[model samples]
Target chain A: MQLDATDRQLIDLYQRDLPVCDRPFLDVSRQLGITEEEVIGRLQSLQDHQVVSRVGPVFEHSRAGASLLAAVAAPEQQLDLVAARINRAPGVNHNYAREHTYNLWFVMTAPDETVLEERLGELEQQLRLPMLRLPMVEGYHIDLGFEIDWEALP
Target chain B: MSTCTSPSDNGSTLDEQDRKLVLATQAGLPLVSDPWGALGQQLGMDHEDVLSRFQRMQETGAIRRVAAVPDHYKLGYRFNGMTVWDVRDDAIAEMGQRVGELPFVSHCYRRPRHLPYWNYNLFAMVHGTSRDEVEAKAGQIRKLLGATSAGDTILYSSAILKKTGLRLRKEKATS
Candidate 1:
């Protein structure tokens, strides 16, 4: 779906620091000079088109829970089967197939370290594969929001 | 650009009530005119209480931001690369700070390396409109790293097997 000027402006504006209030959309509508209904309508449309994932708060990784980036070298023929098994685990938020020997990579988050470790251990035992456990030691950037170069977008 | 800070430094832990709020809104805020009011109704919180809780979380760094998360692929960022660099241990901290400041680099971190198979410790996620664009951006990073960079590789994602935000398990009843 092609985004009009208003749609682009609305998205760019609300990508960060959305007002915290009872009628946050009303506040946004006033800024955009559109009706509150239009603001809601536009957002709903964007979501329907899968352009916007959701209107929400992004939590700090460690603050929310224990998390890790892990990968496995799933055998070529069993890649889909392995990925499906990994995806079945509740804590696995993201699973991607990358172009490498360690083909499947995923991120897992649990309420705490004990649960996280237990889940990882169980998965390793079940798969009978050595998972590369790469946990972040330090984050160099604050995930404020991505600044999209709107003009470049197709 | 903001400098790097350890996640642990943001020291406030979530209380029971705060955790409840987090669980309720992790999926998203209600897409209504009065989203806070709707959330309050669901969580048994008043409008002011919900607002203040979210504000406090934002201040404490528990909440990064309340915003619309765009689908990069839909926004013309088709090429995504997990660019990994094996930088000199002594220079990683400084190098990571500079690398993360680049506009195209979405996420950057220092992660532990597993020998023999994985040796890159510095990971930066780069998104671009094309493979050439991503490679060009990675080239910029290479130039920046200079001699501090031992080696690097870009692990381009072939497919998204599954994607979702962090989800907290429903608390089990305590005896």
Candidate 2:
């Protein structure tokens, strides 16, 4: 979707701290010199267009649950089947097909490590594929929120 | 001082109320005037109570941030590359931090290399409007890694097979 100047401004300014108060749209609108209804209308439109995924608190996975980056090399023919099975699991949140030997990759999280491992083990046995579980050893940087410069895009 | 809380250590810290709060807002906050009130109504608690509980969670580092998560693909950043590098273990921490500071690079982390089969230890995700743009950004990372980077590859996601917001199911089956 083509973004107008207001949309661009809304994106540029509201990356974080979205007015944690009653009538957040009113607050935001006042700052942007627009009406509260306009603010809400614009946000609703953005949401409808998939520009803004959500407006809420993003929990740190470490605090929310135990998670790991798991991958498996699926035969091209079976890739779809394997991915569909993995996606069926409740713990698997994000699954992707990437260009690599280990093509099917996904992130799984559970309430605890033992539970996570048990689920992964069950998945491995059911899929009959060696699931490589690579948990983050060290997190250097997270909270990757930033403004996108639309003006600079070619 | 605020320190990183490991998921393993903090998993049990989430009480029933916290879990309820999380599950409630997993989809997103209401776009209405009083979202906390909306959540409070759902939980049969006061709006102030909900807000205070969230504040406590934030202080404890449970909630990362209350913000808007934009869709990169919809925002014109069509190319999302997970650039992985096999860098010298000794030099990874410093180099990883530097690479993470790049504006376009998000979610940088050091993961264990599985050896012979998998050799990448550092991962930095770069987003751009096109494959060429992402490739250029990956090139910048390569230049930054310099001699410390033994080998690297960019795994561009072909398809997002599944993507969903976090949810704490009522059933304990998965957990």
Best by DockQ: 1
DockQ of each: 0.69, 0.64
Q: Enumerate residue pairs that collide in model 1.
A: none
- TM-score of structure candidate 1: 0.90
The structural similarity of chain B in model 1 to the true chain B, as TM-score, is 0.87
Off-target runs (Cα >4 Å) in candidate 2 are A21-23, A152-154, B1-12, B172-175
Per-residue lDDT tens digits of candidate 2, residues B103-153? 888789999988789999999998888888889999999999999998999
lDDT of 1 by residue, B47-130 (tens): 888888888788778888898777888888988999999999999999999999998788899999899888999999988898
lDDT (tens digit, per residue) of candidate 1 on A1-154: 9899998897789877788766888999999999999999999899889888888888886776788999999999999999999999868989999999999999988878898999899998888899999999999976655577887666
